[model samples]
Target: MLCQLEDDWTLFTLVFAVALLVPRSPLRFCGLVAALYVLWPAFRFRQAPPWNARQVIRPAGDTGSPMVSVIAHRGGGHDAPENTVAAIREASKNGASGVELDVGFTADGVAVLMHDDTVDRTTDGSGELSQMSFFQLAKLDAAAKHRLRDAFAGEKVPTLEEAVEECLKLGLTIYFDVKGHADQAAAVLKELYMKHPALYDTSVVCSFEPRVIYRMRQADPDVVTALTHRPWSLSRFGDGIPRFSSLWRHRWATLMDVLLDWAHHHLLWRLCGTSAILVQKDSISPDYVQYWARKRVALVAWTVNTAVEKQYYQDVLHVNYMTDSLLGDCDAHY
Candidate 1:
């Protein structure tokens, strides 16, 4: 912002000097340019940008340390049905910066807002999502498993379109978790983005699969892609290494794959800075938190649930974002 202001001021000064040197140059034009250069930011500051970049540049909201940005895990899973419209709406009410929801594809090749391949756990249905049509999937009560009508009254399954609309309606940001086979997620996201061009600025596309994250970028070069991991997924961590072969280009032949593997490994090693150190709940380590914070990598963790856990992340370890299944009332603790 300062650089931008400096450039504008420089241009205005140049224009004013040129006007004085040229005898017939319009004084009104020069004055107007100078006035605009000074007043433009004032008008912008008054109205404020959506995220209010000016406020952050000036250091608002607990500037003492790394900001505590709260991301709703599966849309505040405890407050409402996990990964459903009702839950996302409640997450907005709780003042979450971003709502993270998972995506999978249906048998009919339509994109679905689900976390698993099978609907059995989250909905009143059985079998793989690959075998179901959108019309067939739509009939099942998404919240049936939660028995949420006792609290929420009436909740139903929502399409991705519906989910996006609710976020836009509430002026809430989203951290969409693209799951399932990389190709399926990529294809669905590519098709969906066409329907919501306005969402690009406010949404982040992330996945445990780097290929999926990369594919999201290939679809929309401007989309923000974030890396994610699940410690429990055996498919994710295989024999002490990442399962995905992030080694070679599909468009390349055998010769390039070997060279690329070395490069990626070197890069990964460099990123695993200061060696690995484990910190249990009874102990604290602020330095470990500061490490990722310095890297500007939006550090996040999963299913954190206690005050001790939250403090370990925010006050001690300093994690940037967290997904929780049951923890609530953060404003009270923080």
Candidate 2:
């Protein structure tokens, strides 16, 4: 009900702004009609189903420390070249218990570390990662665009196996942020977990795509999994007004997006069998954390950086959190 009110109020403000700009009666009336059309559905909006509030199963062999776990986001991107070997080492050196890295596949089906669909942003290359072979990708400098390029230049993109090896050697937990190519990535992760049983204790596989988390659980039920979610308002529309849709098709799509966002918060855990929920810091509240905690579902917050944010999630909420900064009051907790 509150969500609908917020939406309607936003639409009303937009309509008022349009009224000020248009002196003519016909255009202003059209704008008013469009606003009313969009706002009418708010009164008929149905609430999402309540959370069932069942006990959540903790992943097997996950005997991690009880203290708040400080996960390094993208291998602490603020410290070193993200998703590279140097970043992994730097994160471990800064006392991070675990390092998160994004995983994607090459054209030849080899799993590698990459956040974006294309290599153009992070590497000295231009192409979709899934279209380039491992050999071709290895030649490009992964750290070319980083702020500390001079210190970390010539760093090559590390294969998934190579990244696991480095994390194992450093005794840092591995948090694989599965970006795409789930089937191939799942196969590789299953192989690694089977060969190196320690990963079952030291690693977690997480994704915003529920299908990827589901696939990981199916392939290796013992592999720890976390469902990543950010509300649609933040994820899709940010602070801007929702895009105006004249056609019914686009309006229906928008309604579905709203429903899905509600499901992510209220129902996704039951459907996906995730052991933990990785949510954006702003989307979480003390009550939200307590609800999941009672159900034995761990809550992991992401990309928290400031001292105030760190203190709230750690000291007040007592939930695990990931951060881009490794050295500060945040790392002290680790």
- Identify the candidate with maximal lDDT: 2
For 1-334, candidate 1 gives per-residue lDDT tens digits of 4533544455457567766776664677667676866764443211113242211211235555336556677787667877788888888887776677777777787765788778897777788888988988988777777745467644655677788889878866676777747777766676666778656556666665556655555555545455554332332242334344654433243344454333222232122211111122222246645653443333455555566676666676555454543345432110
- Pairs of colliding residues, candidate 2: none
lDDT of 2 by residue, 1-334 (tens): 4533544465557567867687768876787778676655542212111221111122223565356778889898878888999999999999887888999889998888998899998889999998999999999998898878899999999998899999999988888899766787788899988888778777888898877876776787667777787665432444334544456655675677786776665555655556678887877898988866664567889878888988887799877789987776333111
Question: By TM-score, how accurate is candidate 1?
Answer: 0.63
Candidate 2: worst 10 consecutive residues by lDDT? 47-56
Evaluated at residue 60, the lDDT of candidate 2 is 20
The TM-score measured for candidate 2 stands at 0.75
